[model samples]
Target: MYEKLVELQSSTHEEATQQMVADEEDRRRGLEAAKLQLAEMEEKRNVSLLTPFLKVAIVETNSPAFEAGLRSGYQILQFGTVTSTVLASQGPSALMSATAEGVLLPVWVREEDQGEPRKILVVPHRWEGKGLLGCSFDPIRAK
Candidate 1:
């Protein structure tokens, strides 16, 4: 009877240890999933912060802006570091200063027909036309 009791206690201890390990694994996986979900939420919030402040008035054919997939009626959400707030305070100079020759600038734009915004890299380089971008932009005035 004494030997049997020791054997039962040993078996119970082993089972408890295995259960603890399984619970810990499940907890680790849940933590990882929560972290991923938080990251995705932060990304969406950052993208939402960029509001459309300018609209593309013209995009010359074969130009840098045109080649970068910019088109007329597309709204410019963020040009390099120029966001909606910056555009309101500093105006077009902020955007013009951002476009350095031979440098690739990240531009976030929203299409007129689409609800989501897209990112496009525009390289400011001299083309056959006048300006570096060969595109004209108009400010989106508040209603």
Candidate 2:
């Protein structure tokens, strides 16, 4: 009879241990979900205005945008326009300004797997040194 009691106690202990493991797993999953949520929010908040053909490569450490986040593989899919409601001190307006001063052409472009329409705009504010930002691009012909 004592053996039967001992067996019952062992089974109860095992079940309790299983329950604790499951609880820990549940807590872990919940924490992971929260982390992903925060990252998504940051990403949505981080993007700037969309542009066409804006070079999407990262600026080098010695380059102009190095003090900026301009990490390798990060792109400038957009420019000039605000990406979100909250504007951060670190943003892309400087790049746009430089481009306006004949630094580069401002245009919209997207990369692979983005799953969005791949085009943006650049307002034609006539700056002395800048090239054209018009929609119409044409091929040059030999004379």
Candidate 3:
């Protein structure tokens, strides 16, 4: 009976060791998966001349576009190309002297395809959270 009890204890220890090994393997796989996910997110956040910010104007102050380094009075020659839309303040442009906070402005200005400056409004999906450099810093495609 004593020998049987010892045998049972040995079996339990072996089982525990196997469980520990399995758990460690699971943890390793989970960490690898997390790393892969982070790499994918970084790749997706890349800025390319394809999607997202098609056109970019100059920079401004206290503006989401400005926080994104978008200036004002410049030219959104690229992403603003085709039929993309720019989110500006809408409704009343008044900041104070009103009940509500203010209006949201997102104007959609399109460049005429006719003999113009030949600006390319190419926005890459990768530039999602990237800082907005000057619009003219890119290579303008000649028409």
Candidate 4:
């Protein structure tokens, strides 16, 4: 009878431990979901406050963009002859079209709020890896 009681107690302890682990996993999943939702909300808020302008998101090492002093977070106002909303809507395709044929396209960059916008020439050239322009961009939206 004592042996039976001991065995039953061990089973109960194992079940309790398993329940604790399951509960922890459930809490972890809930926390992860909450974190993801928060991140999405933050991104939406950031987009809402920004103006409709394209900004460089990345510049690859030793690429033409990098060599031309193009860095991440630089706002691109004009891509060649295109400007404003037109550039915002068709920036990526326009960039590809303008640069794919070894053309030197003029790009206006507003580096700072107090500084004047300056133009830079970009030649889209194929490199060792990834994007042809060696850069990525994000559209800035108005608040």
lDDT of 1 at 111: 88
On TM-score, the stronger of 2 and 4 is 4
Residue 105 of candidate 4: its Cα lDDT? Answer: 71
lDDT winner between 1 and 3, please give it: 1
* Top lDDT hit: 1
The CA lDDT at 125 in model 3 is 22
Per residue, candidate 2 scores C-alpha lDDT tens digits across 78-100 of 45443222123444454435355
lDDT of 3 at 127: 29
**How big is the positional error of residue 71 in model 2, measured in Å on the Cα after superposition?**
27
lDDT of 1 by residue, 18-111 (tens): 9999999999999999999999677546865677888999999999999999999999888888998987899779988899999999888888
Number of the predicted model whose TM-score against the real structure is largest: 1
Report the lDDT of model 4 for residue 86.
59
Candidate 1 vs candidate 4: the TM-score winner is: 1
lDDT of each: 0.88, 0.44, 0.39, 0.72
RMSD of each: 6.9, 12.8, 12.6, 13.9
**In model 3, which runs have C-alpha deviations exceeding 4 angstroms?**
48-143
* Residue lDDT tens for model 4, 1-143: 99999999999999999999999999999999999999967744543333336788889888878877788878876666555555567755765566664768766677746245666777777777576677888877755
Candidate 1 lDDT score at position 119:
78
Cα-based RMSD of candidate 1: 6.9
